[model samples]
Structure formats: C-alpha cells, structure tokens
Target chain A: MLKVRVIPTLLWKNFGLVKGVGFDSWRRVGPVLPTIKVYNSREVDELILVDITASIEGHIPDHESVSDFSHECFVPLTVGGGIFNLSQITSLLRAGADKVSLNSALFENPGLVNDAAGQFGVQCVIVSIDAHRTERGSYTCFSHSGTRNTNREPLAWAKEMEDRGAGEILLTSVEHDGTMNGYDLELIERVASRVNIPVIASGGAGNYQDMIDAVTKAGAAAVAAASIFHFTEMTPLGAKDAMHEAGIPIRRRFEM
Target chain B: MKVALINYGMGNLGSVRRALEDLGANVIIAEHPLMLLDANRLVLPGVGSFGAGMERLRNGGWIEALYQQVIEHHKPILGICLGMQMLSGLSEENGLHEGLNFIPGKVLRLDKLGCSLRIPHVGWNEVNYREGMGLFNKIPQAMDFYFVHSYAVVVEDPADVSATTSYGTTVTSAISRHNIFGTQFHPEKSSKSGKQILKNFLDYTPC
Candidate 1:
C-alpha cells in the first residue's frame, strides 16, 4: 500500500520563513535550515521548500542555499520558485533537489513543463497552481506568487499540466491560504479528479482533521501545511497519527 | 569502505554521497569510469528516462568499465531507482532501449499492466525483502522506501528478486544476484530505514 505523504512546506522570503493569508506572506517565522532538520526526525514523508519571492523578482533559485538545505534534508526534498529554463533545473538537481516546482514560469511558457518533463523526467517536474475564487464564484489560476490572474481555470489547467507530463500538481487555494480554517476541499476534489497524477493539497489546514479531510474527502495523495504547523502546536506526526487512526495508510515509523 | 557514486551526467549525487560519508565511509563522486577502479564498491545513482540514461552511459564509456569493476572484479554495486532499471537488459520507455545487461531483465511500464492506480509510482511504499542477510541485514522486513518512477524490472530468473512491493501489482522493488544489487527505491531519501539499508550495503562482502 502507498503511504499518504505528510509534507511540511516552508515558505522562504528575504532570508527567513513566513506565513500569510491568501499569499501575502508578510509574517516572519524563522530560518530554513533548522526547520528542515527538525522535520527530518518528525516522521514527515517529504519536504517542500519554496523561495516565495524568487519568481516574482525574476531571479534564479539560490543554488547554494538549496544545496545546504538539501544536505540536511534526509527525506526527498522538492525545491521550487524561480525555476525557468533547463539550466536552472540542472543546477538545482546537481544541488541535491530530487524535484523542482514551477509556478510563474509555467504561466509565461507552459512548454517549460513539457521541456522539463522531457529533459529531467516527469517525476521531478511538479507544477504549482495557485487558484483564487473570482467574484463570479469560479476559480482562476494566479501567478507571480499569487499576485496576477492568469485567467485559466484550475480544472482545465490541471488537466493540461497532466497532459504535458507533470508528475504531480501542488494545488493551492489562495483564499484559503494561511487561514488555518481547512483545505479548499471543493477545489482539491475538482482538480484531483481531473488528473490521474497525484495532487498535493495545500493551504488552509487548521488541525489534524483538516489534513485527514484533504486526503479522505478531497482525494489528495499528499497534504502540505504551513500556518497550521507554524502557528499551532500541531506537528506532522500528530497529523499522520490522526490519519493513521482513521485507517489511512501512512508511514508512522520514522526509524527502528 | 571506499564507495564511488557514479555521475553519468544524470541524477542528484549529493544526498547519496552525503549519506555514505555520514556513515564514515570514504566516498567519491566519480564522473569518469576510471574512478570506479579506485573504490571498493560502486554506487550507481540516477533519475531520468531509460533511453537517455543508457545513451549517456554508452557515450561516456561507463558500460565497459562498470562491467569490469562490478562483474569481473566482483566488487559489490548497488543501483538506485533509474540506476536499477539501467541494470536490466531492456526498457520500453520512449521506445525500446537496451540496458547494461548486468541483470538480465526488461523494464516495463507499471500503468500498462492494467493498474488503475496512477502512473509514475511516487511516494513511500513497503519493500518485502528477507531481513538479516546481505543487502537488507539489520533492516526490518517490508520496510518503506521512497520511490519515483513509471517503469519496473521483470527479471528472467525469479531468484534474482531479493525484494518485492505491491502497488496495484507486484513490482520488483529490489534485485540482488551474486555481486549485483539494485533497488527501485531511493534509500538515501527514505529516512532512517534507508540509511540503515545503505549501512548494510557498505558492510556487504561477497563470498
């Protein structure tokens, strides 16, 4: 049985970690290295470290920083933000990133996903989609760290990404981001049902029930949390234990 | 133990190299085939399509050198993920591509095997291997390891399979025959159980 992954997402900006509601990302958390080291022993299945400002500033990923983080990240590390071309992907891979996530670059050139999937295998190419509910009540994809509206619907965009060979999709509902309310179960179910590839549910997780809901109700293969971990006493293990108690197949043993 | 992680212009070598070094084993990131001669054991780590990986290995002149070091010299070698697939005889990914033939087998797509489950089997899954011997010594049976790949090896001989895992189907998760060892999972990225498996590999000695 495949274990449902519990991933701790560290949002990086201006040298430290931050949490924001709906992608504002203004509040300060702490450094990146220590968070990763702690997660290493915390029974989490994977770690996703995204430099929140890299793509918005039109800069490349900080290879040195990623290398340092990955050095300490014993579990599989997925690095995202500011990854545009093949060279950047190569640099990150050599820097120890098992996977790279693309957001803004995918809006500019959707073929980057195809090219990346072609060059570096689809398993390493993860396309991050930030979806916001429009005034009319339909969700539209947002880019530039959830700044600009790409005018593309989440369901259609997710299907296209899957067709383009993206191994996984990091689906985030911007309105629910940092709210600690719960995952956008409707949006997650919409996109996850549309694609055969695994969908990682992100944004709006308040407690262990929220994480379990993302997997049980929303059909997410994995659940990624930020504010719930930073703001509350909730740990990744606690979330996994809750899910495991609910009869969800999750990796409980960190070590022997 | 001297362990050389092969870099054929593919995959990430940092995590594997660091994992070995953390265990107090002398490690080398070998970009050339000649470097394999210096190490007591070779660690072939890669992440990519089967066709592209084999092309690089052949062009880089790694096939012959690997055969000499791992086959003739009997120096134990462990192949990880795509590295494990390349040890097989052929792969059907992006058309049929020939492998190193280190382990006589063919790589086939998991989805094509009537699996309703998603393609590119990603995430942690249990590996059913015999414990307390050779590669899996000290590691618990049916341990979970991280895996990310669409294809798996089907060896001609069933005894070549040292471990197996079920994900809508029985995928060959690990293979061990004589001195050749291959794992479809990423032990370096598999948390503590993986680190223990690597330690066992470092301690492995051929008869």
Candidate 2:
C-alpha cells in the first residue's frame, strides 16, 4: 500500500521562502535552498513550493532557483505559480522539479494541462484549485491569486482537473484558510469523493487532531500546513509522530 | 572522482546528480563529447521520447564518443529510465524508432497490452530478481522502486534481463550486458533502496 504523505507547504516570494497566515503577511524565513535542506533532514516525504509573487510580477518560476531546490531536495517536490505553456513545464521538470502545478493557466486554456501530461507523464503535472464559499455557502472557484472568482462549482472543477490528467489536486478552501477551525469538511469530502487521484487538503490546519480529522473524516489524501510549521508551533516530525501515535500509518525517517 | 552525467538533453539528470553526490561521488554535468574524457564513470540520464534522446545525442557528436568510451574503456555506465530504453535496438512507440541497439528486442508501448492498468506506470513498485546479479546481491527481491513511463523494453532474448517487475504482466526492470547496465526506474528518487543500488553499481567490478 502507498503510504500517506505528510507535506510542509513553503511559499516563494521574491525568490525567498516565506510563511504566513493565509495569503497575506508573509514573513521571510530563509532562502529556499536552506529551507529545503532542513525539510530533507527531517525526512519529510514531500514538499510543496508555491511562488506567491510570480503571478503579480508576470514572471514564471526561475529555472535556476528551482534547480537549486531540486539539487538539494532529497524527496519529491511539487512547484506551482505562473506556469503557462509546454515549454515552461519542460523547463521546470528539467531543472529538477518532480511536478509542476497550474491553476490560472487551466482556466485560461484547458488544453495545456492534457497536452503537457501527454508529452511528459501525468505524474509530472498537477492542478491546484483555490476554492472559497459564497454567502449562500456554495463553493466557488477562484483564480489569479484568489483575486478573481470563476462561477464554476468547486467539486466540478476538481473532477475536470483530474480528467485533464492532473496526477493530484491541491485543494485550498479560502473560507477555512489560516483559520485552524478545522477543514471545510464538506468541501474536502465533496472533492475527494468525486476525484480518483489523491487530494491534498491545504489551508486551516491548527493542531495535530485537525490534520487527523481532515484525513479520516474529510477523506483528504494528504494534509498541508503552513502557519503551524512556519511559526514553530508544530514541526513536521512532531505532527507525523502525533499522527502515528493516533494510529495513522505514516512512513518514518529511519536513521541510517 | 569526477563522475560525468551525460546530458542527452532529454531526461532528469539533476536528481541523479544529487543522488550520486550524496554517495560521495563528485558529479559533473557533461553534455559536450570532450567532457566525458575528464570523468571516471558515465551516467546517461534520459526521459521524454527515446528517439528524440538518441537524435539529440547523435546531433551533439556525443553519441559516437560515448559508444567508443563505454565500449572500449570498460568504465561504469549507468542508463536511467528512458536512457535504459534507448539502449535497445528498436521501439514500437511513435512509429518504429531505432535505438542505440546495444540490447536486442523492440521497445513496445505498454498500452498495447490493453489492460485496464494505467499507462505511464507511476509511483512505487517492486522488482523481483530472476538472475543472480551481484548488483542487487543483498537487496531483497521484492524491494519497491519508483517508476514513471509508458513504454517498456521487450528483449528478444531473455538472458539479458537482470530483473523483472509486474505492472499488468511482468516487464523487464533492469538489464545488463557486460559494462552496460540499464534501470527502468529512477534510482535517485527511490529512497534508501535506490541509494544502495547506486552504491552497488559504484562498487561493482567490471570485466
């Protein structure tokens, strides 16, 4: 059986890794290289790096920067933010990223995702969905750094992304983001039930129990945390230990 | 200790570089033909279409020198993923594309099997050693390795197969003929088992 992955989400702003409460107020922690080194040392199964500022500057991820991470990253790494074409995907993968994620580009042109997956393998492609709840409590898809709203239903988009050859879906609920009030269980359950590929529940992780509940109840294939880890409130190893103690089957970093 | 990783301009060589360096080997990303001269061993890392990789190597003038060095010098040569597939003579994928022809048998698109099993077999699977190859001497037979590809090499002669793993049917996972060793999986991304496999190749004595 494939082991459940525990990932720490890192944000890249101006080529530096940062962590924040939701999307704003990002604090520069360290360079991406050292941050990856730290995560690799912890025996983390995987890492997710999103370039939060790439879209604003109209710049794609710097291949050399990604190469630095892949050169040192001991585990699988997924990078997202500002990838729009087949050439960009090729550049990202060639530079060492195991997977390149897209969100805005998917809505702009749907064919790119499938085309990329066809040329490369599906395992190298991922779709990130940023969803937020309306006043009526209906989940709506958001794009362009969550500034623009698409009328498409959240669950509907999840299925579409999977059908478009996304190996995994990075689903983040805007309403629950950084709240730590527990995941929007309804949103997670809705998407996870519909999609065949793994769904990583991102945003609003407060405690170890929340992570556990997200996987067990919400059916999230993986759980991503930022504030808790960035603030040192919970370390990746600590969360994994807590989960293991709670009877969740997770891979451990065995000392060689 | 300068290890030359052949840049055919097709596959994932960066991860392989890091993996080798972790084993204390100084790795050099060598794309030019002369770069191979300064290195001790050669690693041919490949991904994407096998034919394109061969064409790139040929156009770059590295292919001729690569064949000359690995064939005559008896230096360690590790072909990873598609690099492994390129070693064979022919492939059924994207029309009949000619390979390096080092290993016999035509590479066939796994989709032809028509099994419900997903193509580009992703994630981890085990490799069962059928032959007594010292490269995997102490390694368990069913140890899982990360795989991501759609086409597999089908040997005309089974003796060249070092190991086999099943996706729908048992397919060749590793093959070796003299100094040439090819792995269909990426050892760099494959955790501890992968590290050991790389170590075994580094320590193996060539005839």
Candidate 3:
C-alpha cells in the first residue's frame, strides 16, 4: 500500500540553511550536511533542499555543494532553486540528487519538464509551485523565491505540470510559509483534486495535527515542513506516530 | 567485496555508491562494462526512459559485457528501478522499445491500470517478498521501500516474481530468476530496510 511521507524541507540560502517568513526575513538555521544527516537518521521519507536565492541570483544549484550534502543524505534528496536547463539537472543528479525540483525556470520554459522527463524519466522531475493567496482568495503562483508573480493559477498550473510529465507536485503557500499556523489546506486540495499526481503540501505546519490535516483533510499524499521542526518540539518520527495513529499509512520504521 | 555499479550515463550513481559504502561494501562506478570482471557482484542502477537507457548501454559497450558477466559467468547482479525494467523482454514507454531480455516480461505504463491513483507512483510503499529467498532474506514481509517509477514489468513467469507491492493494483515489485534479480523500488533511498537489502545482495550466494 502507498504510505504518506513526512518530508522535511531545508531552505538553503547562501551557504547554510534558512527559514523565511512570508518568503522574507530569512534566518540561518544551520549547515546543510549535518541537517541532512539528522533527518536521514530520523527516517524522514525525503528531503527537499531548495536554495532560496539561486533563482534570484541568476545562478544554478551548486553541484559541488549538493554533492557534499548528498553524500551525507541517504534519503531521496530533491534539490531546487535556480535550475534552468537539462545540463543543470544532469549535474544535480550526478551530484547524488534523486530528483530535481524546478520553479522559476518553468514559468518561461515549461518544455523543460517535457524534455527532462522524457530523458530522465518522469520520476525525476518535480515541479514546485509556490502559491501566494492574493486578496481575492484566488491562488497565484509566485516565482523566484516569491519575488516575481508568474500570473499563473495553481490549479491550472499544476495540471499543466502533470501534463508535462512531472512525477510529483510540491505545492507551497508563500504566505503561510514559516508561519507554522497550518498548511493552506484549501490551496492544497484545489490542486490535489485537479491532478492525479501526488501533491506534497508545504508551509504552515505548526503541529502534528497540521500534518494530519494536510493528508486527511487536504488530500495531500505527503506533508513537508521547516519551521515546525526548527521552532517546536516536533520531530519527523513524532509526526509519523501522530499520522499513523490518525489512520494514515505511514512507512514502518526499521532498525539497522 | 567490490561491486561494479554500471554507469551508462543514466541513473543516480553517486547515491547508490554512498548507500553501498554505508553498508561497508566497496563500490566502483563502472563507466565501462570491463569493470564487471573484477567485482564479485554487479549492480545496474538506472533512471531514464527505456529506449534511452538501452541506447546508452549499447553505445557504451555495456550490453555485451553485462550478458557475459551475468548470463555466461553467472555473476549475481541486481537491477534497480529502470535497471530492473531493462531486464524485461520489451518496454512500451513512449515507444515499443527492446530491453536486455534477462527476465521474461515487458515494461508497460502504470497508467493503463485505469485507476484514479496517481501515475509514477512516487514515495514509500510496502513490498511483500517471498521468504527464504537470498535477496529478501533479511527484509521483513510488507516492508516499505522508496519507489518512484511509472513503468512496471509484466513478468511472463509468476515464479520469477520475488516480491509484489500494492498500488492501485497488485504490482510486481521485485523479480528473481536464478542468479538474476531486479527491483522496481530504489533500495538506496529506502533507508534502513534498504541498507539491509544491499547487505543481503552483497552476501547472497545462490547455491
């Protein structure tokens, strides 16, 4: 049976990891490698390492840095931020990244998904949509670390990404991010209901109940959070216990 | 024991190496098929389209070398994900493509299951493997492994199937034919249970 994954998102900044509020006011959390080691040992289903500034800086993911980080990371590592072409994806994979998450690059060149999935197989391409709830309550995608508005709707954009052969969708609520209030359950349900692909709900996971709500209420296949782990007393394993108790099919933890 | 991990310009070779190294196994990234001669076991780990994986393997002179190493010499080899699918008789991914034909089957798209479930069944799923088999001797029944694949091999022989997993349907998750073995899930990224699997593979001695 398919199990719900509890993924921990590591927002990468210049060198270390950071968590931002409303996609701004960044604060360094810790280094990259050690954090990955901590998560991997905790039996986290996957780790998403996004260099929040890569797209804004007009740069690609640091292959060498990712190589160093992935060596310590045993779980599936999805590296994002500033990826523009297939060559960069290839480099990230060669650096030990299991999947590459594309955002800003998709706004201009959605064909990259088709081509990347065509070559690397659909399982490797992840289209991360950062949705900022506008004043009208309609979700609009924000690109380049939520700085630029792509003017694309999350529902239609997620469907397009799925049509283009994305293996999974990482839907993040820019406003709800770092708030630890709760995942934008409605935003997640909107896209999850539209596409057949698995949707990983991100942002506003303050407690165990929040992760459970994302899966049970929002229909998210997986739940990802950063601040919940950084600020509170929540751990991935503890969240899994909560989700498992809530009747979600969670992966059985194994001993070495 | 040295294990030659075939790198035909497709697949995540680095992740596999780190995973194996964590298990205390010597892993060599084999770009050419010649490296298989020195290793005790062989690992064909890949991620890409069926046609492209075969094209790269053939162009890199891996097809003939792999055949000699696994079929002729009977070297224990394990294929992971796309590598496992390549063991099939054929694949109907984007086109009707030929595979290594090591195991009897064809790789077909999972979307044909006609279920509302997601395609490219990503994330962790349980694998129910046959007991007493060397490949899964250390793995418990219904243990979850990290899986991310759209195509699954339709095995010709039911006895060839070593493990099955539940998705929208009962799908073949692992196959074993004598000394040959393959898994649709990635063991390297599957954490503890996955590491135990790698260890079992290294110690497997098909009598």
Q: Stretches of candidate 2 above 4 Å error? A: A1-3, A207-219, A232-256, B113-115, B127-132, B137-144, B157-159, B164-168
lDDT by residue (tens digit), candidate 1, B1-78: 889999898777778888889899999889899999889889988887889899999999999999999889988999
Q: What is the per-residue lDDT of model 3 for residues B32-139, given as tens digits with 9 covering 90 to 100?
A: 778889999899988778898999988999999999999999999999999999998999988899999999899888867543467778878889988777888767
Question: Which of 2 and 3 is ahead in lDDT?
Answer: 3
- The alpha-carbon lDDT assigned to residue B34 of candidate 1 equals 91
* Model 2 quality (TM-score): 0.87
TM (chain A), candidate 3: 0.99
Q: Which stretches of candidate 3 lie over 4 Å from their true place?
A: B94-98, B111-116
Model 3 residue B111 CA deviation in Å: 4.7
Model 2: per-residue Cα lDDT over B1-207, one tens digit each: 778998777866777888888888988889699999878888887878877887898899976787778877767787888888888899877788888777787788776754347677776667888657856766777776678788888887888899888888777889888778889987777766777778777777865
Q: Give per-residue CA lDDT, model 1, range A1-256, as digits (tens).
A: 8889999999999799988898984799998889888888786799999988998898866999999888888798999988889899988988988899998888779999899888777888999999999888899999989989899999999999989989899999999999999999999999999998889999999999999899999899999998888988989989988998998999748454
Residue pairs with backbone overlap in model 2: B11-B47
Reference-based lDDT, residue B151, model 3:
81
Best of the two (2, 3) by DockQ: 3
Q: Which prediction has the highest lDDT against the true structure?
A: 3
TM-score of chain A of 1: 0.98
Count clashes in each candidate, considering only residues at least 3 apart in sequence or on different chains: 0, 1, 0
